[model samples]
Target: MKAFQELAETLSTTLAAHGLVLRGGFNFSAGEESPTGPSNAPAKSVLLVGQTGSAPWPHFLRWWERQPRDLKDPLDSWSREVIGAVAYEFGARAVSPSDRPFLPFQQWAMRAEGLKPSPLGILMHPEYGLWHAYRGALLFDREISIQAPENPIHLCDACIGKPCLNSCPVGAYSADGFAYETCLSHVRGPKGAPCRDAGCIARNACPYGTEYRYAAEVQAFHMKAFAGL
Candidate 1:
């Protein structure tokens, strides 16, 4: 079998064992530096990104919720561990963006590759809604070629009301963009209702992922962590 096929199988087995159900539409691109030219970065040298499910992220989410307001630094370790495993499997490294070494993937997707926009941004998938978060990414060392699908399966195309855009209490998300301060203030207020309890109303309003329900308790846990409540 080719390296790409092997990598896919290995990823499927590894993530499935952890109760993560890998879906289609995982777009892989070449890394910044490679033996071959940028245009020639084989599909094999890839970045693995997918949504969470099969095992609910709520267990982790809930733990994050109850953490004392001041002690959340430990969660960063968990993030590294999860992202690292996938990187190792692919003989690649995990790149989490920092203040330095700003990522070019988003720009590459838009300018060079010609994706209309980020897939998740459009509410295209019915299963994940907006509740799903892109937690980690994996990068491979070598290049390999895989067949590209003819067209992207955009799940958000059918929705008319676009509940995700409207559901937010603060209208943080819209065609325009997010208002970070407005969202942060609501979640952080001493007496305000916690964002974790009900979840991000806008995210919850998505019609996708019937099987992937965001439990309220889990939502509250995430909210408290995010809001520092």
Candidate 2:
């Protein structure tokens, strides 16, 4: 167990410098079900890896700029290179959110942290609001003891007026559900410059963890990716 803890700590510290954190994890040996069903990778446990706020944006941008422009999914490709190297060093298998046999990351997150979904369908983090994101996971052949985070206060429940529902001009988010096509159409239209340049208006309207909001450039980058611009 000491060795496992040490390994986890080393990986956690190394990832922290790049603004990624050991979000949560579970041991399949302890009878915790596999979120990805069955895998032949000899994984005995899985560690959830993610980022909060915009701390990684600058570093990612610098690294991304240095990569060949012709490469597809540069961000995901870069993440695979960095995280995969770490997994290799630790004798673990690295998996990404973009990987096939698509792992149920949202389920893994909820089970590992007791997190609830927000109005926009994204997991509502207590400290990062909607600004946080899960990037990838590391699958180990040995079980590592990991403590689940206590259930946090659902900030959305207490929010009066639910600004996220009203902030989008195209009514992309509402009580009914998100209007995916409506949003995409609006974002690709002539009037989409604001959303294209600054990210989703509804997401920015969330009051929780306002301090962790991404910078304009970072937000714009994400918007561009979402819009395929």
Candidate 3:
């Protein structure tokens, strides 16, 4: 147990240098779906990697500035490179949310952190709120002692106004689910400058974790990407 804790700490420190955080981790249960290793072996444990707010912006910007400007999905590519290196050093298999077959990353996050989805479909962290994101996961053959931490409260349950659902100009998010086409059309249209320049209105409306909110530049980058600009 002590050794595992130490290993986890070291892993945390290593990720921190790259502005990443270990959102949480968990060991697989019997007969559960899991990520595979080189030999098609099932992973016994998983550690989720993510960033809080703009924690990774500085590092990403510095690295991005060096690469070709025409690269598509730079953020996703960067995440793989950084997290892949960490996984290699730690003797783990790295899988990304963008990976084919799309590993159940959202479910894994919920199980690992005991977080529920907000109205916008992003996990709501008590501290980080909607400002954080899970980038990838490290899969290990050894069943390290890790499990999800439970948070007693779901922020949405207590939120009365639900400003997030209402802030969108297109009403993209709703109980019926996300209107992806409507959203995409709106974002690609001329009126999208507000969202493209400042980020999603609904996401920016969340009152929680305001301090961790992305910087204007970071938001602009994401918005442009989201709009496929």
Candidate 4:
């Protein structure tokens, strides 16, 4: 059984090598404790999450520059390759928690050997604000012991501007809560002011993630996914 500290160091180094910055709350667990749908079988695993940095644009540019200039619309192969490699290397399964029901899936991940919150949303680093995301997650079968992630600090709590809330042209995200349908309509190319450019302006205005900006193509990809396009 590989210990958690050993695993963290390995993953942190790997992500750093790829230009990603490892934020707080790098949670890991045995495969026996991971999220699984009611019908989906659970597997032994561990999860590693971190910010992909401010410039995923360069990643997109590099991917784009790889093929013949005439070829357009890069394939999903690149994402699959990146994600798959992480999964294989870590002796764990990999996935974004959002791929399933948000709350339940997260709970499943936190159930001791199941699933757990990255300590105070520690994985939810304040710097990238919420603009960054866990680009990939790995699940492993081996039991690896890791130190508790650093206690998380909610950066949003300190912001007077509350830019993430105000920046939304559509006002999709409200302190009261999100209006998903309205946001969905606008991103799907609905006639609206806020989401015209693919996502929430408020999110873009977030100072935390200014460095780890999402590439335009990644934003488009996410917007299309959100819109169910």
The most accurate candidate by lDDT is 3
Tell me the deviation in Å of residue 83 in model 3.
0.7
Q: What lDDT score is found at residue 44 in candidate 1?
A: 35
lDDT score of model 1? Answer: 0.53
Task: Please rank every candidate by TM-score, starting with the best.
Answer: 3, 2, 1, 4
lDDT, model 2, position 27: 76
- The total of clashing pairs for model 1 equals 11
Query: Is 2 or 4 the stronger prediction by lDDT?
Result: 2
Sorted by lDDT, highest first, which candidate order results? 3, 2, 1, 4
Clashes of 3: 0
Q: Which stretches of candidate 4 lie over 4 Å from their true place?
A: 1-3, 16-45, 54-57, 60-77, 98-124, 189-194, 215-217
Candidate 3 accuracy as lDDT: 0.89
Query: Which of the two candidates, 2 or 3, achieves a greater lDDT against the reference?
Result: 3
Per-residue CA lDDT of model 4 for 47-72, tens digit only, reads: 54534544444664577677785553
Please report, as a residue range, the 10-residue window in candidate 1 with the lowest summed lDDT: 111-120
Query: lDDT (CA) for every model shown?
Result: 0.53, 0.83, 0.89, 0.52
> Better model by TM-score, 3 or 4?
3
lDDT string for model 1 (1-229, tens) is: 3866776677777766544433332334434342222233433344434445325354345555766656644345445566567666556566543213555544323322223432225333334544444444555434445554444454566678877787677777877777777888877765347465667777667677756755676677667767766
Write down the TM-score for model 4. Answer: 0.64
Candidate 2 has an lDDT of 0.83
For model 4, state the Cα shift of residue 199 in Å.
Answer: 3.6
User: Which residue pairs come into collision in candidate 3?
Assistant: none
Every model's TM-score:
0.69, 0.92, 0.96, 0.64
Worst 10 residues of 3 by lDDT: 144-153
